[model samples]
Target: MCVLIKKYKHINTNNYNVLENALTYDIQRIENDLKKNHNSDYFLIINDEGRLGKMRKIQRINYIPSIIFLSEIELLIEDSLPKASKNSRFIQILDTISYIVYLYCLEHFNNSRWANRVRNKLNFEDVINLLDKIKNNSNIQASRTNSYGIVHYPR
Candidate 1:
């Protein structure tokens, strides 16, 4: 499944009309293409539209960092379970971003062995670093490539 998560600040919703409009457009395009190609992939959109109460608790208590730290530990957890006990949503997002980074590198450096290097060096710290790098690069490239989207239009 391909989940596209948009994590905007909870209170910034009202000011994100343009972002919402662009998200709708991209989601529609993804859905249409998935349908047309008969792909099993799925797209999901997650926003902080109605989670103010939860956000407030985390915000006021400074619990967000602990939650994130727990997330990292979950990714490192091991068991006889069906899959990693990590935050499923976060794992899924990380996987998707990692795949995108590999794809980008494959396309950009046809002869380089960066993918193999990344796979071999995939440790907890390195993986976190890799994810951050990929997320940053993906955001940059996505914004640059999607320049013609509705959000870029002057209202």
Candidate 2:
């Protein structure tokens, strides 16, 4: 596995609208790329920071199933309390974004031997519920500690 790092300044909280728009565009682009590049393994890393730099790295590498980071999505949902009008639609957007990723994996990789081995582990509902709880400020509990260390989920 290759790890690449890039540096960037922190984002201002007030600019979330711009961030949200960018994320929406990137997610759609990723989905389209996945459709066109069916043979590549697309790995998207979602986090609250370092999104642009990571995206730039992936673009430089010219890798397929392009890697993307959903930092804007996480920031818009987790950094502030949800409000009416503006932030309310975040949940729906997140649902659509994650569903696209999940659907791509299921439909494109289903025939792969490794996919069959790990099919039971791919659950999109868990992701949606986690985002919902974050948006609603509900209690979230630890689900399981996989080889990836500790993982949390909405109970």
Candidate 3:
């Protein structure tokens, strides 16, 4: 079986930037700990070291499927509907897709920049195309810092 270790919080955030090599040692140590105790067949060790956030962007789409966050999605829409459907069916689908992408971004980081961007859009359909581009290509970490850098998400 594969072992998933969320080492980001487990490691002290204050030391992460200076502990790159230490993190590698920590991974091997975790693997050994798993093999010795938990599972001998722990062939894969997936570590989410938050410092190396950029590496996860491409692979996150494969693992961050929206099905698992169904309940969260429900809560998200509990009080939230665009005041304009108020528009077309196409607009609705695009809104749904953007919400899904926002949820995906939320998985990686706790920031609400994506939701805020959607909230602050000029019109109901303002950022549909931009949201589509962000869906599978970007991670929330990037979305947070690079807010103004992204297309259509201006300051």
By TM-score, is 2 or 3 better?
Answer: 2
User: Judged by TM-score, which candidate is best?
Assistant: 1
How well does candidate 1 match the true structure, expressed as C-alpha RMSD? 15.4
Global CA lDDT of candidate 3, please? 0.36
Clashes of each: 0, 1, 0
> What is the per-residue lDDT of model 2 for residues 24-54, given as tens digits with 9 covering 90 to 100?
4444444443455554544353442335444
Please name the candidate that would achieve the greatest lDDT relative to the true structure: 1
Off by more than 4 A, model 3:
1-83, 111-155
Task: Give candidate 1's TM-score.
Answer: 0.25
Per-residue lDDT of model 1, residues 11-118, tens digit only: 465655443444334443444445556456544433232433332222211211221242111111121122341446765665566465444333333433455765
Deviation from truth (RMSD, Å), model 2:
16.9
How many angstroms is residue 56 displaced in model 2 relative to the true structure, after the best TM-score fit?
20
1-155, model 3: which lDDT tens digit per residue?
Answer: 01122344556656543243333333333334444555534333232334344333322122221223311111111221223442456556645654554444444344434546546753334444545465443332222444421211112
Off by over 4 Å in 1: 1-16, 39-86, 89-155
Candidates' C-alpha lDDT: 0.38, 0.36, 0.36
lDDT score of residue 114 within candidate 2: 28
**Model 3, position 106: C-alpha lDDT score:** 43
Error of 2 at 16 (Å): 8.9
